[model samples]
Target: MRFVTDPELTPELIDELVDCWTDVSNAGGSVGFVPPVTADDIRATAEAAFARCGDDDHLVAGFDAEGRVACWLILGDAGSWLRAHWRWVLRVMVHPKHQGRGYGSRLMGAADAAARALGVEALHLTVRGGTGTERFYAGLGYVEAGRIPKAIRLAPGDDRDEIYMVKSL
Candidate 1:
């Protein structure tokens, strides 16, 4: 249950993240995009996260017992000036093959602890509108902060809500 963070992104690291992220999205897990996602989509996200945005952006990952990256979660700040009281949680994905285990929870707990160590008071995250993912976050002590309808649209006729959640540190 170890979480690894690196501010610098290497080719090798990008490939690994793209592979795992693509796998999860294709398997109907929402990490940012809809199902049947491609490597390009994930690579684009990695590039943005890896870029020098002058704010706190980290690539936090966790390896499985077999040394495979089974889960990852992005722990970042508000990306604005002098606002670090809360961190944003993004891309909290557990490989489809590794679901049902506590890999996601472990990663989240570690991230929470890490943020707490930095004197952060709470964490904010959002889940897809219709995925029932809010329940999962709620179980981890997250509460509903807000919800935006039709905030996500995968297809012309497919639209779901975006649910914002928060957990006190």
Candidate 2:
């Protein structure tokens, strides 16, 4: 159980992360985008995201004993001045095979620690409304701020709301 921060996003790593993303989305995790997320799109997106990390943001990954990436967590740098008081938890995902193994919570704890180190006083994230994940986040001390009706479009014919949550460091 090792936690790494802002690892250089190699093509292989991007592929793994994208696979996890696609799996979770199809299974209805609701991080962003819809199912059928392609490996190429993931590669391109991850490249840009990693470029941002090179600037200031942080991307944390959890690797298992065998060195396989089990979970990923992203935290953006506090904006110029106004947003310096807080950091956001973006795109948190644990491989479906790794779910229920406490990987998500471990990754979140690492993200929280990173935020505190960066002088961020609070952390925020959004979960799909009506999903058990919302309760999972709540159990981790995140309070429900509100919900955006039909905030997520799952597919051409499917849509779901999102619940905003925040936790103070």
Candidate 3:
């Protein structure tokens, strides 16, 4: 299980990644969007984000033995003077078909190693509170640092807290 980083993602790569993300989102994973997501919707969002990314932002992913992209996470540089020492983990997920094969662990471990290599002392990420995501990160040695109540709204009356987690490298 080797981890690779694509610092400059191409158009084709983004399209492929959007497909992967669509699958994850449609399966009811909290990935910055509601369920029943579409590839076009995610692709447009990705285009906007790519336009704003700094040079150091990158895509960290792991491929399966069949040569398909099984999972990926974004490593954000925090994009600020004070927070430069930290990296933000964004949209980390293993496609539903690839889950429970130890791929998520390898993906997260690689993200941590990459942060350390960049002289980072801490990593940050947010997950929807009141779900199993926080537990998953805790198992990966992350500590719950904070939570904001009713911060994320999935629908009209459906809302969830936003949990902030930290892992010190």
lDDT for each of the candidates? 0.80, 0.80, 0.83
Per-residue lDDT over 1-169 for candidate 2, one digit per residue giving the tens place of the 0 to 100 score: 8998878788787777777777776666666766566656565666676678745688888988988888887887657777878877888989888888898889999998888877789998888765678888888899999988987776665677888899999
Q: Give TM-scores for every candidate, taking all chains together and pairing residue i with residue i.
A: 0.90, 0.88, 0.93
Candidate 1 error regions (>4 Å)? 52-55
Error of 1 at 161 (Å): 1.1
Candidate with top TM-score is 3
Scored against the true structure, residue 167 in model 1 reaches a CA lDDT of 93
Q: Write the per-residue lDDT of candidate 1 for residues 23-91, one digit (tens) a residue.
A: 998988887777766898778776786573224765578887776778887778787667678889888
Q: What shift in Å separates residue 103 of candidate 1 from its native position after superposition? A: 1.0
State the lDDT of candidate 3 residue by residue for 73-98, as single tens digits.
88887878789899889989898999
- Candidate 1: residue pairs that collide: 129-161
- Tell me the lDDT of model 1 at 61: 83
Candidate 3 positional error at 156, Å: 1.7
lDDT of 1 at 28: 86
Pairwise TM-score winner, candidates 2 and 3: 3
State residue 108's C-alpha deviation in candidate 3, in Å.
0.3
